[model samples]
Target: MKPPFPTLIATAAVLTVAVTVAALAQAPDPPQRSAGSPPPAHAFPAPTNLKVLPKNLTGEQVHEIMEKWKIALGTHCNTCHAEDKKNPAPDGRPQLNYADDTKAEKSTARLMYKMVEDINGNYVSMVENSGVPVTCGTCHRGHITPEPFVAPAGNYQNNGPPPAKDGEAPKLPR
Candidate 1:
């Protein structure tokens, strides 16, 4: 004799759900990031006050771009982005006020970004088939300020010895 219709229907429903869940469980995981590679561009929410970069970037993309800047300038986030002392994050780290322009470094960084953009977009493109773009590292070389001059050796040279004072001998070259 056949089983009751209600019991059969319930059993079928349960089996169907179980089979679907099992199939999903067997599905492969998402791809993992390689060592030293930046996280996926869509990892975080879009940040605010992006004057140079495109405004539609995802949080992850913002972070990755910032990482590039940090490496280029040999600096951390606090170099340009100021920390909000009053409103700390839940993790106890000072929350960065990304939109604030109180720091002079932030202003300078904006100018630097514009300069790099101009160099790459205007100057670099003008060189036929030459795709080399100038960046902060081109000048900074891992330093905050690029050294303008190499240290000179020995004492500074003069045209001739100074005239002798009444009590002093004429200063002569050794």
Candidate 2:
């Protein structure tokens, strides 16, 4: 049976409103900017307290290296950087003190960087002829902390070395 004309019009109006509302909801918002505010296009500031990295590195080079560390550790700028309480930015966003080593994580990262450098220089050079050096990604794998190794479940006693081979005199150390 067909509904009355008024009823059909009301149903159509409701459907139209629903469709319009849905479309508006899904539409992307227009870019917003303040009349007096400019976009952040300034170059990154030069590094200050470069304890682990070379002191002679250019500010731009330091910035690029930091960017790589950010990617390798799957972290943001604030992960190791503390807010610049002394020289805050005008925009009210936390300005970072890139040189600050107060944060424990930052210190730990410094140690890790040194360890990686030593491994690549001293160890990898000795063992591998590939010429490709080890990097933070060798172990971190885009994680802040590499996964720990754990032995599989077993009934071995004392966690001692495996039994000596037969007739090997138990391989006792003098």
Candidate 2's TM-score:
0.59
Candidate 1 ranges with C-alpha deviation above 4 Å: 1-43, 149-174
Q: What would the C-alpha RMSD of candidate 1 be, to one decimal place?
A: 11.3
Candidate 2 per-residue C-alpha lDDT over 1-174 given as tens digits, one digit per residue, 9 for 90 to 100: 765998999999999889767655664322222223444355545667888899887676787788888898888888988888988788876788887777888998899899988988888888756587878777787899987766666744545555789887564332
lDDT of each: 0.76, 0.75
lDDT of 1 at 24: 56
Candidate RMSDs in Å, in order, are 11.3, 14.6
TM for candidate 1 is 0.60
Task: Give the CA lDDT, 0 to 100, for residue 2 in model 2.
Answer: 69
